[model samples]
Target: MSAEQLPALVVVAPLVAAPVALLARRALPAWMVATAACGFSFVAALALAVQVTSGGAVSYALGSWPPPWGIEYRVDVLSAFVLVLVSGVATVVAPFAWASASAELERERLYLFYALYCLCVAGLLGMTATGDAFNLFVFMEIASLSSYVLIALGRDRRALLSAYQYLVLGTIGATFYVIGIGLLYLMTGTLNMADMAARLSDISSTRPVLAALAFITVGVSLKLALFPLHLWLPNAYTYAPSAVTAFLAATGTKVSVYVLLRFYFGVFGTRIVLEELPMSQILLALSVVAIVTASLVALWQADLKRLLAYSSIAQIGYITLGISMASREGLTAAVVHLFNHGITKGALFLLVGGVALRAGHAGFDRLQGLARTMPLTSLGIVIAGLSLIGTPGTAGFVSKWYLVLGAIEAGRWWLAAFIVATSLIAVAYIWRFVEAAYLAPLGGATPRAGEAPAAMLVPAWILVAASVWFGFDTSYSVQGAARAAALLLQ
Candidate 1:
């Protein structure tokens, strides 16, 4: 395909495959279709990233119509980087879903699961790639609605409640986002992001524009699970099927964060939002609370999945903390942590699926002596956990290093100290699992079980290996993040 066609193909491929998977009506065939579609999308995303990085931004107008009159898909350094991350995680998680879904879902419902999974992937890609504000909202709903169905497919009855809760909150968030976009449209007479950015500069200080910014920030914060608005996340993730949890945890919130970045820096510019308004201070304060409070809450959780869910909030705080600084190093830290945390949490959640398969649950009591029973899976979790704690020579440490440097560059010594202090909280929770798996002996009366099959183990370890590999070789993530940061600030 030509470079111009690449952006549309990235979204269209998986979107077309969703209906095909649903029509297949057979579990294996549906899974094959979904996996192949995701793989194709990942390749397209990588191609788009390379093209944009080498050739500058790529914009494609639909039906040969140009921007401000026709819908356009734009790919810059930031959007291209996010496209690769979302598609890459979806591709890695697709094969592993087969084994995990077979175990959790009924045979009749397996095809439906694959169908929704494809739609979710397509929606995330579309949201990242679109240049129109209305188009972004459309894609956001497509992903969110599919996610509700996927979460409700869990074996547990509470999955229904979690899905319902997410549905209600998600709708509110989408509504707020639409309202903000509507206001922007009234002010600028355009829905294209680039056009909106150009027009917003003329009236950015007006009351309507400031109100639009407020609505958008609150709406995106709820969607991204930013601190106090994060009530929907833990239960939703905890009750969803393991594969669903892993996929959503890795890509869903990250896309929302991407939206925040696109609007805050790309459309509105940093000066108005970060300086004229109180967004930076508000985000910084909430991020600190999320890091400290969520980590403490995670330390007391009995269920392993729920523990990781809480830890996800803390990690997201780290990402937003970097963004709140509004400096070059700060934005780079945010982008790098977004990728690193996605892989680290994805690896951890995938391993939790293994624990759920063999132990029948992921509670700490059930995980005793798992090191002896599921050695490879346990090892993967340990390595991922170390990354979470920001141990040196791990992917997590690289992001933290940049974050601290950003803090220091801003002359916020107290913020730098707070970052280190919260990392210790991560250490406390990680050690909880380590102690349970290694020191606590298995009870003799417990049922016998072995390691998860190769399908699940392989994908989980691929991410685990990536955590170490990216840690030692930071060229792709660090350099891409720096370039993306510079482009955003320009």
Candidate 2:
């Protein structure tokens, strides 16, 4: 299909497959349906990315209706890049789900789980693609609802509590988002982002506009789990099924970050957020706190899954730090880290999934001497871990390098130093796993810790391979992010 058709297809494709997955019940036939849906979404995202790169920004009026009057699905390089990240991660995570699900989920619920997964993907895609502010909330609810269910479906009883926590926080986030959208509509009498942007320019300094900004920022920060607002994340990741962990870890908060970008840069305009107000300072300070605090917490985690979960908060801090820089370089770093960290976290979580398959849990004590039995999986974890630490020649380095460059450009030497300092903290937490897996004995408890089934390993390795590949061959992702940043700044 043409690029213009791609947006509708992106949303509809998954929605259609979701029901088919539900109907495919018991036969395990839903796997194919889910795979096909994700595959189509992936291709659509790539097509959109290609079109955005080669043809520039494209917008589709829903039902041929113009914006501010009707909904618009905007596909700039920025949103397209995020679409690619989200859909691509969903597609990759599905295969891992096949094997991981059988062990962690009830047989009958597999189809239901996958159906919800597609719904979550659709919701996220809708959130990113739609140019309508109200429509964004609609999609946000769709994604949040499905995510709550997916998280709760974990085998452990704690999964229920984790999901409930996420639900409460997510609901609050969505409600705040709606309140903000309502405030914007009240001020501008329009639901479209671009239209609102143009109208909001006049009253950018008004109390209502400032209030809306505060509401939206807090709402998105909660969704993104920025710093102290991140209470729901550790439990959500640690107790959820491994495949769910991989998918949510890779795309969930990243999507929230994209929402922040859309509102801060696309709707409110950078002049108001960065200059008219003090967004940069607030974001920068919070981001630094998240990096240091989250890492400190991660260093003390005994469960490998929880450790990576805390690390995600720190990683998000890097992305937010980039946004706070508010320079082209900083935005570029934020965008690039969004992708790089997605793959890094996905690989790490998927590796944890593999360990779960073997020993039925991912506690650090259980993973001792796993290197001897699960050589390939452990090696993949090592590579991903190295990337997470921003080691040279890894995907993580590119973003951190750009981040440091952005700080230098902004003349914030201490910020750059803080970036490096946090990387050491990353190394410290990652090293805990490295030591437990490679150096310590298997401790008689993990005799069955041979290796995960091939299904799990394949998907895990794909992410690991991409982490290494992107680390070395940065021309594509970097260029995409740089161009996307320029458009966002414009």
Highest lDDT among the candidates is held by which one? Answer: 1
Q: After superposition, how far is residue 480 of candidate 2 from its true place, in Å?
A: 0.8
lDDT of 1: 0.93
Model 2: weakest 10-residue lDDT segment is: 442-451
**lDDT at residue 56 of model 1 (Cα atoms):** 96
Model 1: residues with Cα > 4 Å off, grouped in runs: 444-447
Cα deviation of 381 in candidate 2 (Å)? 1.1
All models, RMSD in angstroms: 0.9, 1.0
